[model samples]
Target: MGFINDLAAKFTFRPGRGRKEQNGLLAEELAALAKKIERLAREQYKANILAEQSISMIHEQRAGLREEIRAGAIRELAMGLAGDLLPIIDGILACLDFAGENESLRAGLRSVLDRAEVALARYGITPIEALGGKFNPSLHNAVEVVEVSDLPPEIVLKEITRGYRLGEAVIRYSEVAVSKSQTGTVWPGME
Candidate 1:
């Protein structure tokens, strides 16, 4: 009789009661839904990880570029300061030239000048060649003209005052005496 009642209940429909088979089916559906949610969560977690890595890479690149720019700016600032100090260097050179050629004094002056020259050379300050070269109106100022037979026309015979330069830019023009050929020299359009 017990077995018959159990079998009857399996085939019978109950209206207002919890059934074992229905509970099992509902639990199975909930478990399947939970697995789907877990899969989606895993995908989202991986995506977030990738995005974080990308952001970190971008930040590192930006930091490297920033450092390069800073280095470049510092180098440019150093060069500009050196350029401003050129005139002061020229003053030092002039002092050395003006001092008399006493051995002890000259030795002391030469030592100081040599050090300054090395520093200036590192910073691109160079002496302009003026004597016995072709006179460039741009770099040499003709304070006087003299007739000479040995030199070519318009050549620099003497540099009255030395000139200094910073790289390609002339800080001061060389004060010079330009030579005119003795025989061929004539006034403009007087030939």
Candidate 2:
């Protein structure tokens, strides 16, 4: 019976408990809930800011990629036009050789060729160095091999037709005559 009475007392509310105290406890619980909600809101705001920054960075990268592609296309077009003009320029040069006695015709041909060269310069097209320089398979295509005793073998003796380049890319390889030493002076420095 004593155990049963103790259990009953635990379940019952004491007479000292008042509505004022219950209201204070409820207010404290509500304040704690409000603090938790504020913290969550601040975290959500920071996440949104980070997401916006990521999106902006992605947009900038995409724009840069587009610019690079456009520039590459322009470069290719200019190179193609320059290649087509080279044959005409070479023909004008060949005419100068035949115009030995005709000074007026030679001068006129030279002027026309000079104007064409100036136009090519606007697009950064330039001729490759070949004559009197060491032969490079990439820049010069050997059209003839001449036997010489003084100069080193593989040296470019003459440029038959001019080669051209746009920056690092070769538009056409120069047709050239390369030298072959007859006396077997293979190493210039050794002598």
Best by lDDT: 2
Q: Which ranges of candidate 1 are over 4 A from the true structure?
A: 1-84, 164-172, 182-191
| Model 2 lDDT tens row, 1-191 | 67447545644566888877866765776687689779989999999999999999989988998899887887887787786888899999888888998999999999998898888878878889999999999899999999998888899998889888887888889999999888656755646
In model 2, what lDDT does residue 103 have? Answer: 95
Candidates' lDDT values, in order?
0.76, 0.85
Q: What C-alpha RMSD separates each model from the true structure?
A: 11.9, 10.1
What C-alpha root-mean-square deviation, in Å, does candidate 2 show against the real structure? 10.1
TM-score for each model: 0.43, 0.64
The residue-level lDDT of candidate 1 at 127 comes to 69
- Model 2 lowest lDDT segment of ten: 3-12
What would the per-residue lDDT of candidate 1 be over residues 75-172, giving only the tens digit for each residue? 56646755676556656656666777667876887787678667766756666898889899889999999988766678898777767666787766
On TM-score, the leading prediction is: 2
